[model samples]
Target: METSDLAALTDRARRLGADGRRRVLGIAGAPGAGKSTLAARITEGLQGRAVLVPMDGFHLAGAELERLGRADRKGAPDTFDAAGYVALLRRLRHPEGQEPVYAPAFDRALEEPVAGSVRVPADVPLVVTEGNYLLLDEGPWAPVRGLLDEAWFLDADPGLRVSRLVERHVRFGKPRPYAERWVAGSDERNARLVERHRARADLVVRLG
Candidate 1:
């Protein structure tokens, strides 16, 4: 069933504590799976004590992708800097006594990543992070599996996922045909890859 209320998540976070014992929650799912939406809702329900750090901020820039001939494989597992993301999460896992930690954020309008977009205060105690590969057991992503306090895998109907991807691509300026191609080629492929990781997650959530 879909979980809209985050009271359970927040209560768990409070018990985990911050500054080395903070609860780090991970919501993993494929493209159009609503991972970001769920993370945002959890953080919002937790009020000011919770902060979100998305993995999308680590996406390679368009220019860089062109240089590497990877622009066409934008949503592939290889398109992101998984190591960098893990390193940042590692740092957050052990927050200093009273020092805040900063994390990057992705800009939808500029289609770029910005540094220091989210500042997680020292005592906030709860961190909700969402991404596609969080449960994947490959490469640098392998280490990510051992970091989270609780990992959730989200599942949505394939048709709905495709529809959402097409709408999002068009809203982001891609032509209809190009958007469909991306959803079929890139997004669909990534979805299959992520589905294999559902077994590794602590919970599997179904959403419409």
Candidate 2:
């Protein structure tokens, strides 16, 4: 979490995109391991050379989840639009004279995806994407690993991560007891799934 570490990551991002082709950097971690925060910091440090397209944007709609009987495990791997996410990544990788590729953004307030909310310009050299399942090797998630130039896994103390997740759920309007129970149940399951693929990452970053 040092400034120098972020600087190094920024430099690495720059180099990955130096060959005149767009580079995708993926940040993967457990539910509350701070992948999104690290991705934002790295993109900010890169100045304007990078854009962020988060995996959360591909979260399936509430209605869709309910229809599929997955509403109880909304954050699980199967609850995402994995194929759509892969297709978007493919498009981002080879823009080829097309206009800026618009990506979806997740709206936490409404718990839905807003289409075309993020614009990735043709000239942007880097795309930083963060999510829990980037390193997952099962089903539709397996292809995600090959699309990224570099993948980083963020790790943190289990108790601290669980606390952060609980607070986040509370901030998003869940009651304290419900939030704690959800984290101990659904989020913990997803966290373990993510952890199983940690060794596949190019870098494993331990955050305080």
Candidate 3:
């Protein structure tokens, strides 16, 4: 079923952690579709019982993207370290004895991934991971769906999503014109790819 109630969503996440066994809940969405925002809210609602591990942290460094000639399409599936992200999911699912797990974080200001920026304590019961490709069924992304205990796909109006992406890019220092172009060109292309996998999610969330 589709829902837009934030309180109900947060309550659902709370129940996910009630068993005390570590479980991962994934929030997948297109660019500017609110994946990170939803993940953070869920994590905060859990009151330290859950942690946020974003898939953006697995983005290939700018230099590597340039070397592979994929810099222009930075958010595409091929531009991220997909396997590494999957491996981290596995580790979070089954941690070593009494040890905390560390995950990378993306630094939006630097436009780079910072290694070991998130620490998942051994006692946290839920891990909320968000990304664009969590429900993708191709190549390395195929394993991600199985790793998640529950997955939610966020869908938003196309025009609103594009506008959010433009504002985000401009806020991050891109000129308004370039931000608009990049959102229309790169972000929208990836958004279409992500939207195709919507049926794979356990739930579909529509935000107003």
In TM-score terms, which candidate is top? 3
TM-score of each: 0.92, 0.96, 0.98
Q: Write the per-residue lDDT of candidate 2 for residues 1-208, one digit (tens) a residue.
A: 2222767777887888878679999999999998888899988988889999999999999999999999999999999999999999999988979589999999988989999999999999899999999998889999999999889889888999999999999999999999999999999999989999999998878756
* Off by more than 4 A, model 2: 1-4
- Cα lDDT for residue 22, model 3? 90
Q: lDDT of each structure? A: 0.84, 0.91, 0.94
Q: Tens digit of lDDT per residue, candidate 3, span 59-124? A: 999999999999999999999999999999999999888989999999999999999999999999
User: Considering TM-score, where higher is better, how would the candidates rank from best to worst?
Assistant: 3, 2, 1
Best by lDDT: 3
lDDT over C-alpha atoms for residue 139 of model 3: 97
Decide which is better by lDDT, 1 or 3. 3
- What is the total number of backbone clashes in candidate 2? 0
Clashing pairs in 2: none
Cα deviation of 184, candidate 1, in Å: 0.3
lDDT of 2: 0.91
